[model samples]
Target: MKKAEEVRRLERDRIKNNIVVTSTDAKGKSHEDIIHAEQIGTKIITSELENTAGKERVMKNKHKQLQERIFINNKLTWEEREKRKKMKQRMEEEKKKGRTANMGYQKITIDGKQWK
Candidate 1:
């Protein structure tokens, strides 16, 4: 049989082990009463792929730079802008040529689901 002090200590330890934490997500939504180390619960915080987010951030920066160059930067002469456009076009064409020359085909199809 357990002593009275041991029973009280066990109850106190159980209460201390059950921890609750609240947190907010990227969308400014607040989560409440998030119990720790439980089987059933809502996600207190969300996660995303860093590479995907980095790609989106890079695209946004590129678009902003292009817009600034085309509209805001008046120091660039019209001829200079035209030259830049032509150079971009040439680069695009080169990329297309490279793609056509060596289009990679999947040879190892055994792990189809893993690839997918």
Candidate 2:
């Protein structure tokens, strides 16, 4: 049991240290894509931005904007996807029960106090 727990702990730690890389073109717009390194959890970026060529201010602005768009799009998509799935499931269940009321969802709240 101890060995198994150790393995799970290692796996969790590995996931936490993960890093991502995104490269952009000369215009500061994303060139190809924001690539992600998998299990290695580390990224080595190889791009023109390495030298930060061309106008410093313009390049920086473009890079920042591109990164912001990618970050917001990726974050919201992943985070909200699960909630969307739950909503769909609830709607389906309500349909099956022939209920038309708009219902709020309750996550299984386990109160420590037991019913006597």
Candidate 3:
């Protein structure tokens, strides 16, 4: 009985250590509230990643527009610029949304908590 209980305790610890939990407050605020023994390697944070990616996208767009206005726009006629811009806008609107068929998370929930 003692050995079996010890084994179960250890397994529980292992599982707890492998999981991370986040919490949110009522005023639309969120934070990572719990993590049991921290993992050895890098952990990819979803919100931080999205924020960084958004900033990068804005910077890239600004640079592209600047380059186009400084170089390409000067050489092209007004009609040509509007044509290219309209075509890009149409293609952007037609772009696909959401994930591919096979994309998913391999996570599971335990007692209302998520585990990866």
Candidate 2 C-alpha lDDT tens digits along 1-116:
99977876776444332223343322223543323322222322322222223224333445565644422111123323576567667666766777653433323212232211
Q: What is the TM-score (0 to 1) of candidate 1?
A: 0.22
What digit string (tens of lDDT, one per residue) describes model 3 on residues 2-104?
9977876766443322222122311212324322222222421112212334334433444453433321111223343465566554444434442122211
Score every model by TM-score.
0.22, 0.25, 0.21
- Model 3 CA deviation exceeding 4 Å by range: 1-74, 97-116
Please name the candidate that would achieve the greatest TM-score relative to the true structure: 2
Q: Please list all clashing residue pairs in model 3, or write none if there are none.
A: none
lDDT of 1: 0.34
Where is the poorest 10-residue window by lDDT in model 3?
19-28
Residues 1-116, candidate 1: write the lDDT tens digits: 57966875766444432322223221222223223233223423222213434334433444453433321111223344565566555545656666322111211122122111
Question: 47, model 1: CA deviation in Å?
Answer: 39
Error of 3 at 32 (Å): 59
List RMSD in Å for every model shown. Answer: 23.8, 12.3, 22.2
